[model samples]
Target: MINNKKYLVSFMLLVASVFTSNGQDDMDKFVSNLLQKMTLEEKLGQINLSSGNTGAVLGGGGEGQLIAIKKGEIGATGGSSFESIKKIQDAAMESRLKIPVLIGLDVIHGYKTIFPIPLALSCSWDTDLIERSAQIAAKEASASGVCWTYSPMVDIARDPRWGRVSEGSGEDPWWGSQVAKAMVRGYQGGDLSKNNTIMACVKHFALYGASEAGRDYNTVDMSHLSMFNGYMEPYKAAFDEGAGSAMSSFNLVDGIPATGNKWLMTDVLRDRWGFDGFVVTDYTSINEMAYHGLGDLKTVSALALKAGIDMDMQGLGFIGTLKESLDDGLVSMEQIDQACRRVLEAKFKLGLFEDPYRYLDENRLKNEVLTDENLEAARELAARSMVLLKNENNILPLNKKGKIAVVGPLAEATGDLLGAWVMYRNRDIVPSIVEGIKSVGGDDVEVLSAIGANLTNEPNLRKSLSSPFAMFMGEKMVVDERSLEVLIDEAIAVSADADVIVAVLGESTAMSGEASSRADISIPESQRNLLKVLLKTGKPVVLVLLNGRPLTIEWESENVPAILEAWAPGTAGGNAIADVLFGGYNPSGKLTMTFPRSVGQIPIYYNHQNTGRPFDENNKFTSKYLDISNEPVYPFGYGLSYTSFEYSDVEINKSKLNGNDKLIAKVTLTNTGDRAGEEVVQLYISDPVASISRPVKELKNYKKIMLQPGEKKEIVFEITPDDLKFYNSELIYDWEPGEFSIQIGTNSQDVKTASFVWEK
Candidate 1:
């Protein structure tokens, strides 16, 4: 068996080399020769993009695609399939030079076995956990025959309204950069040429985060210093860790769309940051330039080519019209050659050149695809990402010796638990919250549960706009599989007599991601009405909200005793949730994004710049909103625990330094409550003044510490120059000579502050 395995490896290597060898010793040699043999049209063909017969949000995958690929007219394909992958391989074989087609997918969270959204992962503040999550995602994705994933959306999102913020690492670049590296390492692993490792594409290449008004594909403007100092770190970090590709964002960075901004794509991403990967335009980003008034497709394609976009993702113009532009002298052959070479290099790194059919092997494919192990991993991640929002009077760690009423839309939802971007997880495999509760509760706890309502109250949201919800879920637009009013009344009655009401509420899978953006982020009115009935029962209630984005739950927070913000935990989510509820794991998650008081306070953030009209909660006007307070309902880095902790004795090893010194900042934290719990000791920096207006405070460091009852320890963070600088108004990043505040605390809003002066 060992000898056979060795022989298989040898055979694979030999097969890989012939295609990977660039037909010569050096990759550049192979690329130059290949480019030389290519026609102007074929070179132009290298820049075209096409959709697969299936998997597009707008359309589904086909043989026509195979025909296009075989003619060497197609370069890249998005929304491909296992069958499509095989067909593309056959087509590539028919091409004169036999170059493999690079298949890409929006394997955002997971291709098959999904994990929590990136925002949820950030809440963990655990890099190892985040990496492991990505590793699991990669394993399942590669198993499904996907070569590349447009993931690890590293754009630092401060405004939750951006909708795509659900796809990012939140507002802290320090933490964001850490997650960026973790995700890149997890996706690519130590090997990119290996089967389990899919190429990780770091996305929205430039400043897609600072979008105007938190709108998708919105205009973005920021100083170079601000970009370099904060927003660009994650992209740069991914590049440093060897990301396989980059997706240029649709937003205009400064004044130019990142897809056509030569300075951003070439000067910064490649020349300055030294990233060697190819750049692809975001979905239809190239074609949208006409909307931006960038002339015709011919002019824009030339601009994009010059800007460094190699492959066009779903941009029909690049693939359909680049040839005309080439002949029109709009874009040069050498530029086409460079773009094609980059794409070819990416294919080489993926080890597709060696044996393109390696991933297509049916025997191995059957063995590795969505194994029980991967599902188990997803279940574990789901559990860990669940953050206990509130636990008043120790309402959680539910007693196994009581009548437990598990009530709401998500309690018995097997499909909803997997959440969004979970295109491949088998729903039946996931045990619902009730199943999880019953599994662990055993004969000890009497469990009664009811689906109080659908995820929303609006007939338009659940059913159809014009139709009544009577025939919904069976005929018209489905309103979940349960009866809403019947379920709610039953749940209220059940909870009226129960010892505890574990009211599971919040969004179903269709609620908060991508185009699922909400103007009003709150628990559904149907569920909220159900909550009112349950709360009236006067039994201690535990609210388990299954949502994607941070929601407004001030009423629940102030009224309900316990709230668990389980942001659509994946398969086994119910089980993990049960475990946390029964004290299996003390919830340690902190919010990466703030929960505002209302949608009116949409842009609220902890790291926000102090405006000229700053409001002190004491005042009514200025920066404060009259109807609602300026403060976030729940601040970023805020999460409650069953046990309590105390922070004290902050000490700095050195107050001042002339050089790049490792200044140690320490704080003593004690588990003051009886039960042992974990704490995220957040460290933030405040630049009193800068060449540009800067955020009042920025996250610089953090440590998640676990302590037994009465245990105390000091966590020390080494301060560095990198943490002190920001991109100035002039686009230069350097720390100004001024007093800086180093604050350490349990949450972003409440912190212990100290002053230190930086002198040159």
Candidate 2:
């Protein structure tokens, strides 16, 4: 019977392989035939990605874009409304080739039905939930006539000062890789031909997260070993999972702009990683190469094509100069043909050739987009994304029937909660924090609300920092005319009669996104003062942060009775926050990024190579901070739940193992508290001795499990030589036989350690 089952499985695998091979063969023949019919100008046109709208990223769009579509001078367009997309598709049908124009959008976290920001979502440590969120995003985006998404931005970010960190999974490469694979699976699904599934574009191809000084579009310098071992895993993982496309970043890699980096785009992504997807430049990045001192527009366009960039995004570089370059012998006809073939192949795989309007169905738009089910999922995801940073003396799970004072600038905010990268949403339907409290608490709860402070004291700074999106949406930065003292006095008076205070404060919608980096990542001074005064009223205060990146909240940690990192919890953010506060749900989200105690610790992270002189409290000459402790305010993977959990010492099956042998590590976890909750069991592996210096520990694997009150479960993890491998100084990835420490715990800093030995 066992032999028969094995034979049956083998047969099924063979059948599936043959089916995939046949599909590829068909796609190649179709794309090749279409390429032969194209003129040199037409070939250049196929690789040109124009913008249909002006929001999100900077690009050119207007009536000219429609004319280009009709003339077959544009292949793809992004940032367009459903109505606009229909018109664009109509123009494409009128062209000579009748090729469908691929509609793309930056569907980062969610579409119309917004979920928590990516950083917040990573805190959940639930890949299934993350993938589900992506699936919903794809469904909504595809329903709105978008066939592609520039998402799953898998750049591994350790520096919170980089505002784009909000778009990626947190620090650890392994964790980011898992999230990357899940996102691809969710967006692309098993088949891109499905109407609800859109092609996923893994973005910022090279290292954009390791920007110098955590500044946007800054130069990135790193050794090849560092790239392979530290930051390149997530991008490779997304591509391995069959993401259909990639986007070059705005930054420079190895002193060259990523848009024209041959080593990064071709050698690593294609030659080493075997990524078959077409590469697109980030918003006019090809033209910006001239500013990078590369050459003139035509020279840079030729260089970009030679670097294996398949599509020019809104630069007009390929369309405007590729023909001239081809004639000058700077670029070859074969190169242009290859680039154009990739784009057409992508569309062919999406089944656009058979039905260009497959994703433009009006019925799907009406029935699928922002449905009740999607909102409910968003609410649940938002609740799970919240990390309970502090719950001193168990101040959370506040009684539902109390005089709850909800005060802060974000208390009644609707748009700010959606965070960045949200181009399309119905802001009118978003519920405010106070409204959620009232609705969830029912008639028994009396909710007193007040905007205790403005988002910032400097109105001019706020106006200057206002995103261009505000102008597009016909919105203005509305500043409160009331004095800070007056607002604080009113807040104090309102909270005097309340039993507890839920202070919703943090960054506005304009903060912590692309080009929105901050020197100070903390609560604004006005809001901090209000929080300080609220504490003086003898009321237990819950600091609910609604920001994108991890914030420095040392003062709040020491003073506030409770704290929650809400992270701009999307459209249903308010409802989710209310549910967690009222004990309807227990927070299981953990911090993916480290929260430093001060701005001085600019690049703090959990996984770092220990110096020769490691920090020792007993030694004065050690590498230690003179003013503040070296420890972060909140370490990575740290989150508090309503219930408590106790972990037993790690038990190893073998102290010594030979080549290809698997070692088993087990930990018995018990829910010690009297409430049901979930815990993320993190596994870390450390190489005490390696060919080169290694991080103190690296997150290898983790599992999220739920337990009833007082229940116990034995969690097991399997380790092999593969789990202990790292890139040496020579850029060779392999394991060195040595002592390895196995860590099992809730967070990176707090763990139970055991040792094992492995040999080749």
Candidate 3:
């Protein structure tokens, strides 16, 4: 019987060596050998992405993967554990090539040591730190057997209403591009052949962030010039850094859906910018093209392939349909071969061909994943992302001796701080805010708490989808007025005895991310009313805003004495927030996205073009709003440091420069306040006269400096002709010979100015 089994295995090996594949020569030889051993069905199996429907992780995974892999029906799955991925690999070995199954996960932020969300990281303005954060994420994720991450989303969004804005580097293409490269390097590291990192997918490939109405997956429209100059830089940066893959955006670019836009995928992604990676559709994007009125599965699949989409993710378009489409002249063998080779090359680069079970190391998972060091790093990152929105009367840096009334939906809620996209978190271990505060405050600080309101009162949003989403449907975020009043009344009664009120208010996990955006970005009405009652108690009301997006909080900004803009600090968020509140650490965090005074200023940003009638305090008819100020309530790149820094006069190395010469701009920043603090000295350039319209101010460079109380430092920034370059109507990326105004200051609008000229 053993001899028969051996003979049968040999026969099976012979049968495997018949059909299909090629990239790098060594890689090509290895893939061709593997493909020849794979049956036609097995060759076709490498393009599908299935996820288990357990819904534990952020994006989720596919079930029945083992059965599918056995039948050579699926190539890869989007997410899985090391053990599960190993099982899939085992199943793949039963096929001819013994090809390994690729695994993908949403390893955004740190995998285990959950850092501040992407939005908060952008505020740090430190590229090296951002890269290190991604490296930490990869270390933990790889320990869990994840080979790919859907991350480094480089969308340039001007709208704060868009919730996913938190997941990207902020609005400037130059800064965004810099951050994008850092993150890609962080994710991929020096080598994917090693076990410490995974492939990075530069995402929303074309222009998903420019969603119409700032709604998730909404239609997008922009001029070609806008695409080239404003949004595409970060993606190109990622590609230039050798990103392994690209995930097409859910929305269209110009008139075409990104996945099906030949001009975007072929011309721009492949031809113009020269990105050589395979393109994968976002979850079910090709199937959902019907919503975009693109066509049925067959037509859309054909269109996507022809447009250069290499893989279909969760769309079911590339399975059997892709092969038939190939035979019908809809798509050619070359296209299929090209895509297959790309996928195969990725697997090869992952070192899976050398050892398919490389990621299944049990010891690594036990020791390297979620270690205490990572948690400490996460705590530090969280603390850094928290911005002090207000601190009237020195109410913040809370006294540990004071009686504290901590009340809100999120104050004591341990469950939510983990947040969405936290598939890999050790759910129970992350300290809740209440737990964190208690950890340090102890019995010395009397702590009182109340859930004054639920996250939202709405009962039915996408009733069939998720219940948490129902609450954010309207103005009444938490609907139980009497219940809210009872809790608020209790909190008020407690505050009457306490010295201060630490009122934590913000959205639930469901209120921000994909399918989570608000037209009215504000503190939920239930919480707002609760705050009003709390304020009436005459206690020091400190607002701790835990939101996923920048909210419009004009009234709160004016009335509240102290406010903390904590953008959903992940995992150990509660403890991190507690650290900043009680003077354990000073708050140095700043805003990456703009905080609007109202929703009317939906697209408010620091880098807006100088309208023909630009808003001026002196001009009544010049681009002024009828009632509201044209200025944003809170500007982008705007965040307060613990201590104040005074800006000195702007100094330039030279008033004029000839062609191809460089300029040095200098500013003296003095720590004119009592406490040691961090300050982001911003440098913006303005083109007073240009062939085309230009922004009133463009953030060119900035330095985040830490100083002693009386310390003063001179910051010098180098400027080449490259710094002044812009994409003109003719699409040339170069600087125009002209006069440039330099403004140096604390923030965008508040600044000291000087002038320089690049001579013709």
Candidate number achieving the greatest lDDT relative to the actual structure: 2
TM-scores for every candidate against the unseen true structure: 0.92, 0.95, 0.93
Q: Where does candidate 2 clash, by residue pair?
A: none
lDDT of 2 by residue, 114-184 (tens): 98889888988988989999999999888878889999898888788888999999898999999999999
Q: For residue 656, what is the lDDT in candidate 2?
A: 90
lDDT of 1 at 234: 88
How many residue pairs clash in each candidate at the backbone level?
Answer: 8, 0, 9
For residues 1-760, write the lDDT of model 1, one tens digit per residue: 0012433454454344334454325566556666777776676666666743222332123667666666776777753456657767666667666666776777777666667777877887888988988887777667656778888799987676666777887877778889999999998999787878889989888778777777667788876666777688888888898898999988887678789999999988888889888988888899888888887876887789888889877666666667778778887777888898888778777877665655554554677656787767766676667788888888888988878999987788876766655555467677889999989887989899877776676755664322432221111223555566577678877786689999888876656555555666778688898888888888999998887788888898899998988886776687878988898888888998888878788667788778897887776566766677678778988987878898885788767765576667888999998988889999999987766777889898888999999999988888877778776666666677667889999999878877776665
Badly placed stretches (over 4 Å) of model 1 are: 1-25, 52-61, 79-81, 222-226, 361-364, 463-477, 480-485, 617-621
lDDT of candidate 2? 0.86
lDDT of each: 0.76, 0.86, 0.77
| Per-residue alpha-carbon lDDT of candidate 3 for residues 1-760, written as tens digits (9 for 90 to 100) | 0022433454346433431222366677766666656655565577766542223232232336566666666666755576566666666677555566788888878776788778877777777878988999998788777888999889998887787887887778878888899999999998888888899999998888889899988989989787787788889999999999999988977677888889988988889888877788899888877788989898898888889888788777777477778767888776777777778789888877656666666788788877787778778778887888788888878877868888887787654565556655464786767778887786798888877776655454324125544333212133335665577677777778888988888776666666777777787786788888889888889998877788888899989999988777877788888998887777776676677788887788888776777667886778767877777777777777667788889888899899978788888999988888888888888887877887778878888898999999998888888778888898788788889988888778788999988885
Ranking of all predicted structures according to lDDT, beginning with the best and ending with the worst: 2, 3, 1
Candidate 2 TM-score versus the reference: 0.95
Worst 10 residues of 1 by lDDT: 469-478
Please give the distance, in angstroms, between residue 88's alpha carbon in candidate 2 and its true position after superposition: 1.1
